[model samples]
Target: MNRRRTSRSASAEELLSTLQHLTARAREEVGLHQARVELAQALQRKMLPADLPAFPGVRTAARYAPARDGLDIGGDWYDGFLLPDGALGLAIGDVQGHDVEAAAFMGQIRIAMRAVASTVADPGEVLSRTNDLILSMDSSLFATCSFFRFDPVTRELSGARAGHVAGVWATSDGRSGITSDAGGLPLGIQSGQSYPVTRRTLDVDGAFVLLTDGVIEGPSLSIGDGLEEVRRLVSAHAGASAEELADRVLRAAGLTGHEDDAAVLVLRNEIPSREAASPDGG
Candidate 1:
């Protein structure tokens, strides 16, 4: 009886020890993962712009959504700046992978694109330069980007796309139009590939919403479904400011089970009549 009791006690002790060890290992893994996620978030914030520039003649608003759990920050990014010709430069791009490396590459490409645009007024030329730069980068990396130059004075918008997801342009009356082509290759994939530049005139009261694949690619929603959701939301709140539009759209999308970082920027052309404001640039 004494021997049996001793054996039972030993077995219990061994099981307890194994459980403690396993618990410690699991905690270590969780800590490591948390550290990695924090590092990635920090890096992403550092690489992307915290605020866009204010142009004298443009009304712009932007939104960026990192994954809900602080997962990897994808290449979904937007750029807004003033061109030399007093037009607004709008850009959105997605680097191929949703990892730290892709985010870093996106940073480099975005900076290069801004540099190119500063010197080149043509939207197509700026994207072509970006494509060339990306091709010289790592052969395994690829990116899709769209660039647009909007002249508020003329209401003319010139755009170029390098295989990015299409953007939606909505009128104040709930009508929407898709504004991208489907043939251009992503940057870093080919050296000589050229992105086609598309030009159109925005109605004095129209707004454009540009987004990344993360916004549409989810297990629960198809691209068409996502687009319709966006359309309905924008149409319902067509009179709201760009910033308001962005916030409402994000809320509508919700954060439940979202596996990818999402971002969007809304550009609205609200050119008040000459009688609406002072001539000294209000």
Candidate 2:
């Protein structure tokens, strides 16, 4: 009986030891995953602009958030800057995947777009040149991109998109919807592809919302459903300022448990007074 008790005691000890080892291993794996997420988030933040460019009669805001649990590097980016021709240049894009290669490709495409836009004024030409550059990169990566150049003085906003969602414009006057022709073949798919420039006039106190798909999509939601949700959110918060509107959209998206990263850019055409919206106040 003494020998039997000894053997059972040794077996119990071994079982406890095995359980402790497994628990420690799990903790280690979690720590490693957390470290990678932090690193990826840091890299994403560094690549995307922290704040939108501001000028007289023009207000802009952007939000970029990387998911907290992913082994892949975030491949979403948004950029807003003043072009050399005095137009506000805005860009948002999503690379094909979320790996490090995708992130690197995003950066290169962004830089190339900015450089090309600075020299070319038309949105189609800018996108056409950007697509050419991507094809030349010799990678299998593709991206959905949108670019808009807004002339605050003229209130004319012109831009082109390549397989991206439409830019949403909302106003206090109940005029709101997605821009027309908001998509094309994804960049890097075909060289010499033409991206048509869609032009629209933004009356004062109006807003334009541009974002990557992650801003609206969900695990169970279809793209159409996600996009409608965005339009609804924008309409629901139509009266807010540019900065406030950006925050409201994000809060409304409720992306806490979102599987992918999201980036949003909001642009508002502002004026000193309502009469400034037109050449004559009559």
Candidate 3:
């Protein structure tokens, strides 16, 4: 009886020690994961544009959200910048994965596209050049991107979509819905792919919503349904500020419990009050 009791006590002590060790290891892993997330977020911030270029005739706002259930996040990004020719450029894209490499590839694509866009001027040419750049990188990954250049002076919108979901376009006091167009293949899939360009006039006080697939994708809802939801949201809030509209769109997407990282760019054609004075000159 005495020997059995001693044996049982020894086994309990060993088990307790093992449990304590596991608990400590688990805590360390959690801390390490959190640190990784912070680092990844910092890298993402650096990769994305810190400020949207201040163009007088266009109001632009962007938003980015990491995956809710990810450790390092994914390669979803948005950017808006003023081109040398005074065109307001806006872009959003998603690389083909959820890893550091995806994010790195995203950065490469963005830089290449920006350079190509400012110089090329044509939206289709920009994506075509960017596609060539991606093909040259020898990466197995691919990306879906959309590019838009607004000629505020002419109230013209030129866009090129590369196998990405359709985006929403609206006039403040007029009709609003997803614009239809022919988009080419996604980037990195082929060496000499060409994206078709779509042109439209914003008329006045118009807005465009450019986003990644994650924005209109969820488990329970079909992509079509999600798009309709976005359409409703945009139409309902046509007169809101760009910043507010961006937040609201993101909030609406959040309610869908999107598992992928999401990025949104909202561009409005309203001229700033200050720019109103300068008009065409500004």
- TM-score (all chains, Cα) for each model: 0.87, 0.84, 0.91
Query: Which regions of candidate 3 fall more than 4 Å away from where they truly are?
Result: 69-72, 271-282
Q: Candidate 1: which pairs clash?
A: none
List of clashing residue pairs for candidate 2: 163-184
For model 3 the local lDDT of residue 71 reads 52
Tens digits of per-residue lDDT for model 1 on 203-253?
Answer: 557678888777766777876777777877777776788889878766655
Estimate the lDDT of model 2. 0.80
Please give the RMSD of candidate 1 to the true structure. Answer: 3.5
Best by lDDT: 3
- Candidate 3 lowest-lDDT run of ten: 270-279
lDDT of 3 by residue, 155-254 (tens): 7889999988889877778689987889999899998888889998876676789878778898866788888898889888878888888898887776
Sort the predicted structures by TM-score, highest score first: 3, 1, 2
Report the candidate with higher lDDT, 1 versus 2. 2
C-alpha-based local distance difference test score of model 1: 0.77
Candidate 2, superposed: residue stretches over 4 Å from native: 1-24, 68-73, 255-257, 274-282
TM-score, predicted candidate 1 vs. hidden true structure? 0.87
After superposing candidate 1, which stretches have Cα over 4 Å from the reference? 69-72, 180-183, 255-257, 275-282
**RMSD to the hidden true structure, all candidates:** 3.5, 3.4, 3.6
